[model samples]
Target: MKGKILELLKKNKGDFVSGQKISEELNVSRTAIWKYMNQLKDEGYEIESVSRKGYRLILTPDVLTYDEIKDLLKTKRIGRDILYFNSIDSTNSKAKQLASDGKGEGTVIISEEQTKGRGRLGRNWVSPKGKGVWMSIIIRPDIQPIDASKITQVTAAAVSKSILELGIKNYIKWPNDIIINNKKVCGILTEMSGELNKINYIVIGIGINVNLDENEIPNDIKDIATSLKIESGKKVSRKQLVANIFNNFEELYEELLNKNEITHSIEICKENSAVLGKEIRVIFRNKEIRGKAVDLTDEGELLIENQEGKIQKIISGEVSIRGVNGYV
Candidate 1:
C-alpha cells in the first residue's frame, strides 16, 4: 500500500495530488492516504502536504528503496521479488533462509551493510554502511550439481560485463574475482544445496566495492582492494548498478538454461581474463603449484600448465589462484 501511494505521489511529481483524488484512485479512505503519506515522509521522502492542495513530492532520498528499484527493473524474473534490508548479518544467510522457505528463483536479498559478511573460503568481507553492493541471488536452475560451478563463472561474467558497460575496463580472475587496475573490485561466492543429480537451490552472493573511500578499506587489504568511487573519482548510483546487474544476469542465465551452455558468458570471461596467459600459483590443500594459466576450458575450468610442463584442468579443489607477478 505504501509502495502504491509512493508511486502515485512520484507520478504526480511537481504537482499537488489531492487526498480525495488519491483515495478515489487507490480505493482507500482519506485517512488511510494520510497515514501512508506520513509513512513516506518518515522514510525520508520530502512530501509537501497542504490542507487543500494534498501531497506534492518535493524530493526523494538516494536510498535503494524497493519502490524506486522496482520502477526501473527491466528483467523478467531476476529481482522480481526483492528482499531489501537496511542492515543484516549477511545477504547470503538471508537468501538461504528465503530459498529454504520456497522463495522462487531470481529472488534477491540485498543489504546496506552486512555485520558478518564473508567471502570465499570463509574469509571476512568488510561491508560498511553504504560503501558497496552486498547482495545474494537465489536460483533454482535445472542443471546437475556437477555443473553448479558454472554459476560462479556466470556471475563473474555478469558483473564484469556490467563494470565494462560503466566505462571501466576490468578483467576476470578465474573463478570469482573481478580486477581493475590490478586491484580487486568485486568478488563472487556461489553456494548451493542439492543432490548429485539435481540442484534444489543455488545462492550467488556478489560483493562489489562501489563508493567506499580508500580509508574505509581495512589496513590489511588496503593495497589490494579498491572501489569504483576511488577508481572513477565519482559517486555511483547503487540503484542503477543493481538494476543493470539484474538485467544482464537474467539475460545470460536464460540463455544458459535454454541452450544448456553459456558460450557468451564464457567468451566474456576469456576476453576480459586477467588469469589467462599469466603465470599463477594455485594454492591447494597443503601444497602450492605454480603454473601458467593457459585458457578456460569449455566447462569453465582453469587450464594451467604446471612447472613440469604438463597442462592440467582444474575443476574444483582448495585451488586459490593468484597471479605470480602481482595481484590481478
Candidate 2:
C-alpha cells in the first residue's frame, strides 16, 4: 500500500493529488490513504497537505529507502527482499547464515559499512561508513557446480553494463575487476555453499568504491584502486548507482535463469575485455606464466601465448594479473 501510494505521489510529482481519488483507485478508504500519507511524512517524505486537495510530494530523502528504490525499479523483483543494515562484518557471510535458515532466492544482504569486509584473494576490502557499497545476493540456481565460474562472469557482465550506463568510460579486466583508466574501481568475490552433485545456494559479494576521496584511501592502495568521485571529479550519489545496478541485474539475471545464457554473455564479455591479444603474466602461488593474453575461452580459461609461441589455456587460479609494464 505504501509503495503504491508513494508511486502515485511521485508520478503526480508535487501537483495536487486528491486523497479521495487515491482511495478510489486503490479501492481503500480515504482515511487509510490519509494514514499512509502521514506515515510517509514521518519517514522524511515531504508531503504537503491542503484542505481538500489531499497531499503533494515535495521532496525525497537521498537515503536508499525501500520505497524510494522500488519506485525507480522497473525490473523484476530481484532485490525485492532486501536485508539492509547500518553495519555488518560481511554481507556474503551473513547471507550464508540466512540461507541455512531456508531463506528464499534473490534475498539481498546489504550494509552501509562492513567492518571486516573482504575481496578477491582474501584481501581486506575498505568499507567505511557511507563511503562505498557493500552488498551480496543469495541465489539458488539449478546449475552444475562445475559451471560456477559462469556466475562470476555473469556478475562481471552486469557490472560492466551498469557502469557503462552511468556514462563512465569503464571496461572489464577479466575474472572480476571493473577498470577505469587502468585502475580498479570495483571488485567481486563470489562464494557458494552446496554439495558437488546437488547445489544449495550462492552468495556474490560486490563492492564499489563510490564516494571516497583521495585522502580516504590508504597510501599503499591510493594508486591502485579508485572511486567514482575520483574518476568523475565530483561526488556521485550512492543510492542512484545502487538502484541502477539492481535494476539491470534483475533483468540480466532472469535472462540467464530462463535460457542459461552464459555462452552469449561470455562472448560479449570477451569483446569488452582489456587483456585480449596483449602480452600478460599470471602469478600463481608457485610459478608465474608470462605470455600474451590470446583469448578467453567459453570454459572461462585464459588462453596464453607462451614465449615459445605455444598456446596455453590456463584455468583461473588464486593469482594476480599483470601487464607487461607492471602489476595490473
Candidate 3:
C-alpha cells in the first residue's frame, strides 16, 4: 500500500496528492492511507501532510532500509523476501537454516555487517558492521548437485554487471570474484545440499566491500582488498547496490532455471573470465599443479598446461590463485 502511494506521489512529482483520491484509487479507507503515510515517514521518506492537500512526498533516503530496498528491486521473487540483519555471524549460515526449515525458495539473507562472515576455503571475511554487503541467496534450482556450481557463474555475471553499471572499470575473475585495479572488491561462494542424484538447495554467498574506511580494514587484507568508497571517493549506497545486484540476478537466474543451460553458461563464464592465460599455482589437498591457465573444460574444469606440455584438467577443489594481481 505504501509502495503504491509512493509510486503515485513519484508519478505526480512535485504535485500535491489528495488522500481521498489515493484511497479511492487504492480501494482502501482514508485511515489506512494515513497509517501507511506515517509508515513511510518513519522509513525516512519526507512526506508533508496538510489539512486541505493530502500528502506530498519529498525525498528517499540512501540507506539500505527494507522499505528503501523493496521498491528499487524489480525482481519477481529473488528479492521479494529479504531478511536483513544489523549484525549476524553469517548470512550464508542463516540462509542455509532457512532453506533447511523449508521456509520457501528465493529466500535471501542480507546484512550490512556480518560479525563472523566466512569466505571461500574457510577464510574469515573482513565484513565489519555497515562497511560492506554480506548476502546469501538461497536457490533450489531444478538442476543436479554437481552442476550447482553454475550459480557461481551466474553470480559472476550479475556482480560484474552491477559493478560495470556503476561505470567503474572492472573485470570478472574466473571461478568467483570481481577485481578492480588489481584488488578484490567482491568474492562469491556457492554451496549446495543434495543427495547423489537429487538436489535439495543451494546458497550463493556474495560479499562486496561497498564503503569501508581504510582504517576499518585489518592489516592483512588492506593491500589486497578495496572498496567502492576507496575507489570512487564516496560511499556507495548499499541499498542501491544490493537492489541492482538482485535485479540483475533475477534476469540471469531465471533464464538459467528455465533453460538449464549449464554448459552454455559455463562457456559464457570462461569468455568473460580474466583467469586464463596467467601463470597460476594450484594447491590441492595432497599435491599441487603449477601451470599456465589454459582454458576451462565443458564441465567447468580448469585446464592447466604444465611445463612438460601436459594438459591437466582440475574439476573440483580449492584453487590458491597466484601470478594474477589485477583480478584476484
Candidate achieving the largest lDDT:
1
Model 3, runs deviating above 4 Å? 12-38, 48-54, 64-76, 85-87, 128-131, 232-240, 316-328
Q: Residue 44, candidate 2: how far off, in angstroms?
A: 6.4
Model 3 worst lDDT window (10 residues) = 319-328
Stretches off by above 4 angstroms in model 2 are 1-59, 318-325
TM-scores, all candidates, are: 0.93, 0.82, 0.82
lDDT of 3 at 311: 96
RMSD of 3: 3.5
Pairs in steric clash, model 1: none
Question: Clash number for every model?
Answer: 0, 0, 0
**TM-score of candidate 2 to 2 decimals:** 0.82
User: For candidate 3, what is the TM-score?
Assistant: 0.82
* lDDT, candidate 2, 1-328, per-residue tens: 9889988888999698897889888887888888888888776689998978778989985555566566566766667788877789998889889988889887888888898899877789998877888899888988888767778887887877777767776767777788777778888888888897766998889998888898888888876788888998878777767777787677667767888766655775787787777667777667788877888787567788898989987766533356422566
Best by TM-score: 1
List the global CA lDDT of all models: 0.86, 0.78, 0.79
Clash-forming residue pairs, model 2: none
Candidate 3 residue-wise lDDT, 1-328, digit = tens: 7778888988887778998889889898998988988877775679888888878878865445555688788888877887877678898989989988885677789886788898888888888877788999988888878777767877887887777677666666667878776678999988888888877888999999888888876778777788888887887778878888898888878877887664554655666666678777776677878878889775567789999999998765545456444424
